[model samples]
Target: MLQLNGCAAGSSSLRLAKDIAENNRGARVLVACVELTIVAFRGPEEDYLHTLVGQASFGDGAGAVIVGADAGVHYPAERPLFEMVSASQTVVPGTDHVLTMRITEAGLDGHILRRELVPVAAENVERCLSDAFGQLGVGVEWNDLFWTVHPGLRAILDHIDKALRLEPGKLAASRTVLREYGNMLGATIIFVLDEQRRRMEEDGEGGEWGVMMGFGPGFTIETMVLHATSNLRKK
Candidate 1:
């Protein structure tokens, strides 16, 4: 059996990581840190904030997934909600400081979000899709099951929906996540995917398709496509 912890730093990731690592020492454990370039709201003299934008130029978060080869944990033998077909990432140079978040005594905080980022996002999203799909020799069409895009903000979702020419309800899942979880950095997309899987399991339906996407510093975007399986629907 494998246990996975998708938590951010100084929050839950550390304790979860320690518990899993100590107990499942021999399992294939993976730890990933996702850093975002967050613009701090403090009067703009913060060095850490500048370092984040000037050096890393990215907001950051972390997630860990463990797969046990010999442990007797039973993951149902149903078709996966989505088989991760392919993934692509692109970095737009010279666009640092566009988005950012910061940690403080109060808590994590950041900008109020501007509407203009939407137009910038719309122009780049298609290229991301094209590259990701092209690698797999697949073309996108309306019949695709779901569009699991990152919901950085309400405006961003509106921009992406408009740019992609998505259907009215295409981004509902993403929107719901935003309303509930705020932007969880890299973890946001994964949360949406997990929810989609949960919804299918609860409804006893499957064989769906979905796309997952995330954007980060360097003004970069990451994308992946998944094909769900009915066999995996929960009982």
Candidate 2:
């Protein structure tokens, strides 16, 4: 059982799995995640909006994933649920003060979420994704892959959409999950993936290529590409 923190943990989980595959080929690892964001609300301080952002937009939940050098062992090699292709992460150059969740007298508390966050994130979003694709020697059209992004905020998603010029509906899954469940903090992206999995099982939709991305404190950005394999049982 490995634990990860921050809202970006969803993406980081995949990154960690990739690490295991690299060092111990054929070995497997599972990334389990959950968040009790409500616990951090109204802690030692009282900011209604921030607390509402935590309470109204976040809830408690847990999720997990198993990754390894090959999918054959779990599902037929021909069509495993997901094949992790590549991943990358970047830390904002000098914007540490922008977003923070700190440990203080009352446990954990989110500091003031700055107004510059969206603009700054918008400026860096493309470069971050481009950096990931470039590292993997893959050329990507935003419309070419299924997107599973962190549903941080409607405005943040808007800023990302406008900045990346993504196909208008590319982020629907993320937004849908947000509307249905608010933000489950670190567990949100996994819930988004679960949604994709169920969709694939029921409708054989969402194409072959998938892109997973998330942002967390320290203004860290994470990205990954997953290719779907058809399982006769579902697809």
User: Using TM-score as the measure, which candidate wins?
Assistant: 2
TM-score of each: 0.62, 0.86
lDDT of 2 by residue, 1-235 (tens): 4233477888887788788876885677777887876566663355434555455556888888877776675445434577778888888978777777776565665653648777877888888778877888877787777778888778888988998788887788888889898878778998888887777678656677778888888888887877777651243
lDDT of 1 by residue, 1-235 (tens): 2111111221123223434545675544454545442433334345334433332322344444442333333444423245555555566665545544455563344432255456667788888777767777876673355766767767888888888788787777788877776666556665666666666677543335566677654455666666565444444
Model 2 RMSD, rounded to 1 decimal: 3.1
TM-score (C-alpha) between model 2 and the true structure? 0.86
- The deviation in Å at residue 166 for candidate 2 is 2.0
Q: What lDDT is reached at residue 164 by model 2?
A: 79
lDDT of 2 at 24: 85
